[model samples]
Target chain A: MSTLQGAGVHGAASWRITRILSLRWIVWGAAAIFFLNLLGVIAVVIANSFATHWFGSWLPAGWTLKYYAQSWQNYQLSGILVVTLQVAFAAVIVSLLIGTPAAYALARRNFPGKRLMMLAFLLPIMVPPITYGIPLATLLYKLHLGGTLTGVVIANLVPPVPFVILVMTPFIEQIDPRIEAAARMCGAKTWQVFLRVLAPLLVPGLLAAALLVLIQTVALFELTFLVSGPGSQTLVVALYYAVFASGIRPAQAISAMAVIYMLTTLVVLVVTLRYVRPTQMVGTVR
Target chain B: MTLSETPVASEAIAGPERRSLRHRLADRGVDRLLLLSLPASLFVLVFFIYPSIYGVVLSFRPLKPVGAFGNYTHFFGDPFLRGSIVNTFRIALPAAIFNVLAAIPLAVVMRGAVKGQRIINTILVIPISLGTVLVADGLLNYLGPNGWFNRVLMAAGLIGHPLQLLHNQWGVMLSLVITGFPFAFLLTLSYISGIDPKMESAAATLGAGPWRQFWHVTLPLLVPGLAITFCLSFVLAFSVFPSATMLGNPNGDSHVLAVAAANTAFQQYDFPMASTISVIAAAIELLVIGAVLGLRSRFYAGTTTGKG
Candidate 1:
């Protein structure tokens, strides 16, 4: 009878523990609800883009693919797509060119005013684009570079270079310095030490940083929007115009444009995740 | 004998001196690598730094032909322009607080060897990739007057009419949360993951319950990081431009600081006023960040990670 009473007490304690732990369940449930809502948001766009008629109903009345064609022709999406690709690629290549070597120096060297230099680099990333973009855009227009692809590319480059430095600094720091020492000790020149020993190890980091920057540039709207002209508008900017333009076109066409933009970013994002964790991009706060 | 002795001393000193100079240069690898930082530095100096300084200078020259500080006086004098700052804070603060608060629990759970952590992270980051434009577009349709959200509510007999979810403050707030939450979650995860789990384990060994362990041990360690996450989130939300214009009624309730700046520059052709507004927005953003960081130092100011 005493042992049976002990078992009952143990059951009561276990039940209390579970009740306390149900807090975790609440957290997960909230997250799940949020995730479902996001999916629904995206789903509605996709469905409406293809729908023949999507009034207040559980589903669209019918489905079609002609909206994509209408959007492409109406918006001159082909030219915009080309410009988007060119700007994204150009920005990525230039940023990596300037950023990688700086990241290497930052990781390896202990120079005077290094902390100040770092803060300088961090400033551009911390300050929002719209904050500085206005003056920059004004200056670009004054210099005759605004309303051109070059202006957009230059404006977009401001953030990504610093971003590459921040992301790659830690990656370069993770590398053992002794490899460079060993290479030098083997009678390798400084350039040789960098090229033969460091470059191979740095490739993965370079790839990851490049891809992340690429994804950012593709999605980057403010800088591009501020400087881009009618002829030079990127996909996102063009989509914005289409959505807000006089209501001659159907909603389906605008949704179609949004879907295309989504696909472009999603493709790059999927590729980027393979190279780097999403947290590492923004979490290089320190 | 004196001349020979002087020559011998000179040779001895010159040989080692030249060799050591080269040795020092080589040892530091200062030949060309550090100079590589110059190009990137110059690029930022010319593009980022110069433009900001130019903006500040330009703000002194208003188009309305007044004093150097005329734009500032005008901005403060006008209720509509000044109220944009208040409107921005209204949207940014709550969204940022909610993001950080919600992210902490999720980060704590994910810090462990949790299942589907990667999947959850990927799903959360989708809004970031979608960018503000698409997110605004999606939210408009999904939460519109006849959207599925209201449909479900009506089907359940919860409300008689579709709730006004768009063209107001709520629309912008929702968009900011959706886009900004991933950033908060990711930053918090990195920070919480950085904290040494050994501290929590030790607390548990000493008979501390999970809640007690979190409050006493983990919470103190996370204070600095959470502060940073909140600041970053606030900055992003405070600079709301496209979403504020697209989702919210930009002409009235959602007339954020960015909209004011954009209109001053593009619409009114008042470049100086636009620059002035942007500078003000940036200053406000910095003030909030400074305040939070000041608060953070009082909470916990030490090594926040195992790596440290």
Candidate 2:
């Protein structure tokens, strides 16, 4: 026997079907609005950088590259860029040196206290940095490590090392153990197997981790702001200082600098997405 | 040396054969793992653990070498400073919940094969890299009185006056959502996609509707992921300093925990008091995290299978 079409036969109950349909549309419409505003905020900033006067209008009053020039001149983009690069590169190298092996160990060998080890690795990245940053900065200050580039690098390492380990552990686990046995059968030692058999396979993962650490170090503001000295400011910290800096500068000029920051991060992000899924950056935390 | 026998079942047979010549070398590497992991342990120990402990201990030290609660009492006992604790949770709890909720439907939509998926994803993830400070600046211009949002509302005659959106807790909340949403969305989308789509399809074949399939089959598996994201987003919001100062009413109740900790430690040069606030902030954060995780496990009931 065929089932009756209750929704079509019952005229009084027709609103149930319609209600479901309309509710679907309402949900989608809400999602669309959220997506637009998310992108809209970023667009507004990029547009405002070029705007001469942007009040009371959907678009800017006038547009020019003059703010870019002003931002470059006043912000010392050249110097800040150099420091940002140095700090990011140094942090990545240190994190990789320490993180990759730890990842390999965690991946290859199951041992006692493994869960505790993983939890320990997770805590630095999991807890808000500001909670520990206050004390970390104080310690650095006491040891005269604060406000130096070295101090900034040390502080930045607290999170990204865990990140590298988190990202790399999965990659290491994905490699077939049989391949390592083959390399061993050919008379390669553990270090040799890792360097030769594993290094080539791990390059892609290491690159992803490095890029993530790079962007993280670049974008990291709180720890850097706490510990960095006048000479050690990264692009983000400099931008924070510039936001509240004395004197009236054009919004376009500040937005110009923000645009520069956005471009640098975006370029690296595009490169990162090529190597790793966005899911890998986030969902792998567990 | 090679294996003595090529067994039909690999791992099952290999489980008892750890004494092979090649196994020794692999074991050596495994042993070296402890050595290899040393630098990270030292790094975290020196920079992270020691300082955190010092900060906690220092918070308990009294300014006058009096009672153990002197430092905490000096701040928490005072009415003006104590309000910051309430203010911090007020901003954090709702903002965290909002970000996680916003991420869920967006993740659902993104999971579908939408047009311009890559471009859309790139745009969505951009805010993750924008950091809180940049978003605050953007809002100060975009959501500010003269910025695009207000201008649009005014041009359309939707309101007679400019809405008070900036320089308040609301502005700070806006920045947190902007930064927090993308992060929570990315994680949620990953977790949802990780769920076996066949499970939902099976429910559909069993005469379940879309909403019913989602509520019954998918929602149970999503609890753990959502819990972790909520905790993370909440932590991100709780440690509000720059955004609170830049976009919030500094003189108002929104002067949150981290900002207060920073002011006590740095501006006031009261290291003990600052440490005390940091400890309190951390305790509150851990408490919230514990409650969320406990609820999450109860809801999830060990059904999660996405762990790598």
Candidate 3:
């Protein structure tokens, strides 16, 4: 009887554990399916890039880097890389110069129209990019700015500036204005107080903003496609051409190039997560 | 940078005079800030605001040298253009509904205390950064004839011939879902995570089952997030371009508003009609976004008891 009771107890506990385990398994199974769908495309792309010849099989018949090697030679993916980096870097610098001060003013001052100014900056984030891109392109054409690198950069600023301001506002709010007041009372000029005292406190926020802007600039396609002509093609535009203008083989090369692009993005994301704590920034605003 | 021992004529300067000078300096500072804002404002005005106005104006004018309302009339008269409006809604609405529905369960799973949550989250987000062109290319490779899916099906004795997954409406929808699901999932996850876990536990303690607890305690709290995610995903899927052009039959069957606008302006060089379509698309987007924001404010007020 004692042995039977012990077995019964073990069975009861096992039953309870299995019940919970079943729930977990069901949830996780569904999640796995969804995630597989999400990631399957990228897996396929990578697989194709390496496949020597795989058509009627679950797995490739043979694997080789031949396709990737061929793609690199034919597409000049490195040149596109240079073009992407240059445009992204230039856009980030421009956004920083314009956005930093505006963010400071918005965060520090309780002036009239402050709410209105905040709304203006936030509007771009809410609106669709195509809504603005079409009109902006038309205007660029009128102003003789279309088909130029500068035009693409300028069009890009609409979104990046607002993004920077939104991200930086909270960071700027955390800084005690009393530091600037003290410096000013100590006979420092306004510019000197801002340069020496305020800017240093904002370094982390500035870096985060710059990094975000850079990533956005690189990922941007709609505005760049509208404004950029043949000469000013970015990697994304080139990728589009490769897929549609060229054929599948060249497109695979572009996809390889995109994988490289994503790697760069991974690096940026890692750096941002390491250095910039978004929660801390949001906490300061509250 | 030493302070001079000289009195610096402080006694000579009267209180009123010093006050006026300080006021003048403050005024000058304000003026300087405003002056600095001018270049940016002008850039916005000339480039952004002006083009918006020009777009509206172009929509009313004819394509000929002499201006007329002929283009707007022409667009309205064309049944093909009218059909695109229906086509856009048909594609966008179903995709939005499917995406939002799927996202809720996925978000629930993601929010749960699960192993490898971060890894899963990262994988889920990978497609979002890939953009339309790359994703379409991947789809072509996988879903095209002699793709992996067909090979597997044939091997399993499911079918003898390869499936026609591409060059159809289903193809476009599939691509949209693949590209758009991550956005909805992430937004929903963030919103759902913000809910207090205590509420669900409380419901459980009150003799509620898991499903009951979710229905009673979780779903209501998720409405605000659900609405926002729905609107955002709808707008995104509605403005489909590269995927439709690449994977679907874009002649007229899959021509969305964005594509239609491009066809008119770029392909046909009918700038006036293109501008009209763009204006219409923008207006509709603005209205929908406004309605969503309004709903958000109402929900916040009701749920928070006027505290916010």
Candidate 4:
């Protein structure tokens, strides 16, 4: 009996050890993949920027900052960055200005066809970008707005406005309505109540929404590619043309620019996540 | 008698007039709010609603303005275009299956009490925010014939020549997997975490092993999440454009509905035909989403808990 008990104890101990090892293995494996994917892209871009020719080798044969130096000397990199920043900033501001009021209206008031309006706003997100890109571009061209930065910004607004509204509505809903009512009772006007009472409470949500919209606008490809002209091409669209239509050298330069854009976006997203949780924005969707 | 009657009549008239003025002011306040929504409302109507309706109408019209129903007829009659529709379903369905299948094990492994979960989560989510262009670019550099994979294979003496991965359907598939898997995995992980651990432990105590417990208890509970994840990932992969264009040969066998529509509208300037294809794509997407919603309602018919 004692021998049988001893065998059982040994088996249990082995099982426990295996379980622990497996769990540890899984954790480390996930961590390794995460680092490889995230850091790997950065490493490739950095390596390509320096190497004259690194094909067929695990590591580059040589390294220099010549590509970065060349990109700056030509002014292509700075020009694209300026345009990207301008378009993304304008798009985010417009989306926020338009979306906040709609979000407030949806959250605060009981209006007719509220559900229908909500669906209308979300429709842009549901349909594919390709479906709208052509028609929107055609329509913009007809209006003489096509091939302009404003045109690309307008096209981008469709997604960002709805996204902001979706994110901000919950934030607005969490603010105590009674505070607004009390403000009214104290003789504050409707606008005053919104400005003084509610806006402060929604500061985090607003920042989060703005950052999200900005990131999305900067990363957006299809609509911008379809609508943007030579003068208005965003960095992403520019990079795309450089890679596909142009030669490898320009593609490398563009990739270097893309790395900068991606890194900036990552920084913004991390900051946003730290300050404003997605759950706070999208958690109450139900 | 006349003077007294005049004074009373004037007072009565002023009282009614004052009440009507207040009503008008209240009405004006409501009207102003409605007016404030006008700009946004008009924007949506012109940009979103009109384009969508135009797409639907264009689908019915011929590419050459022959007549209504011509373009759709052409789409249906041409075996090549018709084959694209089938190809779309083939790609989207398998991608959804593969993504969901991969998500389960990845989520299961990640859910174990482990350190660095946050870092892993961040890594998984990074691809999602990286957008399709970057993902495609990375895959191109890594998986292309002259890229890392082939180089490694050649060095290892596994193959005499480089393998062709880019400019093929599999290239698009790999791009989709890399981009799509993170979304499915995250959704499944969040869902699985919400499930009470006691149920699994109870199954374990009842002599069921981990695999069996997962297959019976955990999998059943995960159905709602699986359905939603499948639909979401399928919708995303189905409407793929940048990846399809950059990674695959759109003019060749890889032309799906979105690519075909883009070609018609942009390349040919045939808006009607393009619109028609988009409308059809939208309808198919709606039907799939609707079916998933129906399944969700059926599955949760008697349950009180909400499934994300």
Candidate 5:
């Protein structure tokens, strides 16, 4: 029944073939459950966030927007949102100011220690940020920048500048350099050549790098949580404090905050995924 | 005639000037452009590198000189503290292994044209963006006693009693899988797509069965990619903190090293002990990384070229 010569797939009607097809279905079935679980959990969170009373029933007893309003006033999210924007914007702006030109150099030139330099930049993104957050927070405190918005911004910069560099270097490498050369031949200075010749071509790339950094800064909890003080907590840090800081709170109130955080992150994420794949953020897995 | 003739003659005279100017600018431009790397490098070295080094150095500071190392002694002295190290491994090991292995079958099954491949991939990636804190929040309601999960099971009469799933080891691992699976699946899918599809088809034509084809041909080529995915997943799981708190017994069975480290630094103000724990965590991570990389070299020795 089982011989080496006909063992190959051309045999066509073995019990193994039927088993394999069924196994395929099994894998898909499991995968379907996986997606369902993901969506279903989020659905629960969303439904409960607005539910007036979710007692011992399959669905909530009733739904209302009271929790959303209560969370806004109870948690004071507007100020937190402002702080979140400030930190995310600062990180993006400073990183682009510094990382883009650095990326150009790294992309166009061959220098000693370049590989090591690239590795140093890669270290932050590759390793867990929590590993470095402790010391960075301590250092910021020592410098009197700790516990302030400035401190959070500085701590947040560690991961994404390197990320922006990694994102932007490839973009710079793809541009034709002869354009810069031609601009220089017409008497353009270094700054002028970069601005007038290269900058226009790189606008989309810079926007991408900025948006990626922006989302990362908003989503970044470990570093921001480590360094933030009472007055300067970002939305994520504030969300943590809101959930854990008190007693006798309604689940719906916390869920409302979660929903707000989720929506903000998803909006930015949708824009980002439109521009880049997850693989492109790291490297091609292939 | 004056304008045209004068411009042409001036261009001929200024030719050397133009060439000389270009050369001078080009010579000076490189060093200036290279200077661009300095600010960012300085930021990383000062903020990222220097502090990490300081943390390690601070950890090595004497902790009363009573034991092999003071900071580590104090850290390991308390059973609660030492248990964190063990607990971290407990949560990380199974989570990493299961997430990576589960991804392989799902990846292969999803490889061919599925009805909603794009939507599935999108949903898979959503958890990655969810972050641990939000995920843990969702886990609380879903896995808690009165949550819809238990409600559904009760309605179906599948079990008699409610399962105390949350605030335990199972919850932490499940959260890790929820986060880690998408990443591992993404990487594996990309890797599988890289292999020549024709190879598997050829094996099929040779009369090798599906099982044999996958075992003999596909599995061998996937080893290196699997190694990478495994290591990355390990790194992710090893750093579990937020979920461990939200979903597990904070100071009891599910106490992880990260919480302990944070406690020492922030709550206890025991900077030395905190640094010691940080260093150990980093050291353990590096060791695991090295082992996986070593295995990668062996697996890919003849399988890859151009990388070395």
Candidate 6:
């Protein structure tokens, strides 16, 4: 196929074939451009975070570590990081607690209204958070639960619970039902069966789901932004406020905060990637 | 055997006489396991479904306690408020389209064996974890008039002046494309890779060229997945909030509906009005999703893979 047939193919046909093959080059070129820009977006932040000063130049004038320190103090990042971790871990625990059971039931049982129940789990994942987040925030505020860690945790729980259910449902299904039946036949109660048989088998799936939820909660901006108060701001929200606030914060400080946020989520994401397929994060709906 | 048989015999005996709901459900292959889903169902009911319904209800009640449709009227009557829908579409439609379009060729290329596939995927997925806020922050620095993008272009003598990439509609669009592309790409990759490769080989044996094979064998099987991908991406882009604010002129060209809704709720302290805009935004989003999915049904849904 690579060699153009000289005997039968005319000039136009050969040229067309050559052009089509060159499409590969075109594809690679576009991809390269995309990756370059993406890297630039990330690299520029890391660069500016450590730069002493930067203006109309290719690189920062000089590099220093002071902005990271300054941003740590100026943003009260220690408190913000604690809140972020609290919200993330809380979301993971609460979501796993509820979602894993639903996933098990959905996987093992085919009751009436099963489709509707699955749809209920799916709606939160399918809908963008901002649409539901506004009302969710309003509801939380009306209940006087807004502007607190509990509110932030509850708001973040909306997506991951469904996420866990969807993700773990398949994982649960992949486990042999005969194993469960054998455990049940051995005189183990339902909870005992879950504890002894399912839990051990489900640890990997659970850890992956929990880590995904942790990464999502850390990266999740809209829901937390809507419900969180001044003190309840996660790292993402705090970075947003630092950037959005009126004061002319040096670009270095904001970039430093962004780098910190990036590191936190990326660290969790790296762990998540270890257990879960990257495609699973987005394609769980299918 | 009798011990197991005895339970079944007793259930059979108990099935007809004074059957309670629990017995009825158990007879139909449901039992306490089904009940396990109740907590999650209740949680979703209270937080997700209920809030959505409440928001719709609240939209009808404005802050001033006027007529039922006060907030809706207020939203539609104000030109600035109403124009945000148009502005949002202006940003969202293009971002979604570009993301899906750019994703398709790359997805097709990456579906087969590629070198450093894991590393490539890791790099691609990084922006996702970085989130939009960081992406916007990064864009402001990298694509700002004085930043490296313009600097590099200047050094190459590409233009006389640094282009206005940020603080405009273009900046928001750029950020959306950067963030939205990975999502579209991953979804499309999964969909495309799910297709059987032998279909293309089959087409090739019939004297079809690469383009012919893709057009006839691949694309027909891919349309439905693409439609869904487009819908999902469109929904995500339609709700552009943080990036639109940070990268673009929020009050001017980039005044998306989300920004308007957020501003109403937070800045103006009008929760009802915010709910009104949120409802409208959701309605519009659902309409698009429905229309796309509806169109997808027109395509052949026999099987996703070409094996069938």
TM per candidate comes to 0.93, 0.89, 0.83, 0.85, 0.89, 0.94
Q: Judged by lDDT against the true structure, how good is candidate 5?
A: 0.83
Choose 2 or 4, whichever is better by TM-score: 2
* Model 5 steric clash pairs: A8-B207, A8-B208, A9-B207, A9-B208
Report lDDT per candidate: 0.89, 0.83, 0.72, 0.74, 0.83, 0.89
Native contacts recovered, each model = 0.70, 0.62, 0.29, 0.26, 0.50, 0.75
TM-score of chain B of 3: 0.80
Q: By lDDT, is 4 or 5 better?
A: 5
CA-based DockQ, model 1: 0.66
Indicate the residue-level lDDT of A158 in model 1. 95
| Residue A142 lDDT (model 2) | 96
TM per candidate, chain B: 0.89, 0.87, 0.80, 0.80, 0.84, 0.91
Residue-by-residue lDDT tens digits, candidate 2, B1-308: 24644454576667657556446656554465566777787788888999999999988886778688887777877887899998998988888899898778667766767677666667667777778878887888878787777777888999887899987888888888888877888888888988888888888899887788778778877888889888888988999888898889866877888888888877888888888888999998899889999998777775544222
Which scores greater on lDDT, model 1 or model 3? Answer: 1
Q: Which residue runs of candidate 6 sit more than 4 Å off their true CA positions?
A: A1-7, A10-17, B1-16, B19-21, B301-308
**What is candidate 6's lDDT per residue for A115-176, written digit by digit as tens?**
98899899999999999888999999989999988899999999999999998999999999
RMSD of 3: 6.7
Say which prediction, candidate 2 or candidate 5, comes out ahead on TM-score.
Answer: 2
Q: What does each candidate score in C-alpha RMSD?
A: 3.9, 7.4, 6.7, 4.7, 7.0, 4.6
Q: Write the per-residue lDDT of candidate 4 for residues A1-286, one digit (tens) a residue.
A: 2333446767766675576568667756854664565465556766666676676678778766677766555537677778888888888888888888878767766555777888888777666677677777778888888888888888888788778878887788888888988999999998898789888888888888898787678778888887888888887777676567646455456556657667766876687567654322222222
Between candidates 2 and 3, name the one with more favorable TM-score.
2
State the DockQ, from 0 to 1, for candidate 3: 0.30
Error of 3 at B201 (Å): 4.6
Off by over 4 Å in 4: A1-42, A72-75, A248-251, A278-286, B1-38, B109-114, B153-161, B193-218, B302-308
Q: Kindly list the per-residue Cα lDDT of model 1 for residues B1-308, writing each as its tens digit.
A: 99889989998999999989877976766556688899889988988999999999999988877999999999999999999999999989999999999999989878877888888888887898778988988998998988987888899999999989899999999999889988899999999998889999988899887888888889888888899899999999999999899889998989999999998888988999999999999999989999999988866655444324
Model 6 superposed RMSD (Cα): 4.6
Docking class of 3: acceptable
Interface RMSD of each: 1.6, 2.2, 4.0, 3.6, 2.4, 1.0
Clashing pairs in 1: none
Which regions in candidate 1 have their CA more than 4 angstroms from the true location? A1-12, B1-31, B301-308
Candidate 2: docking tier = medium
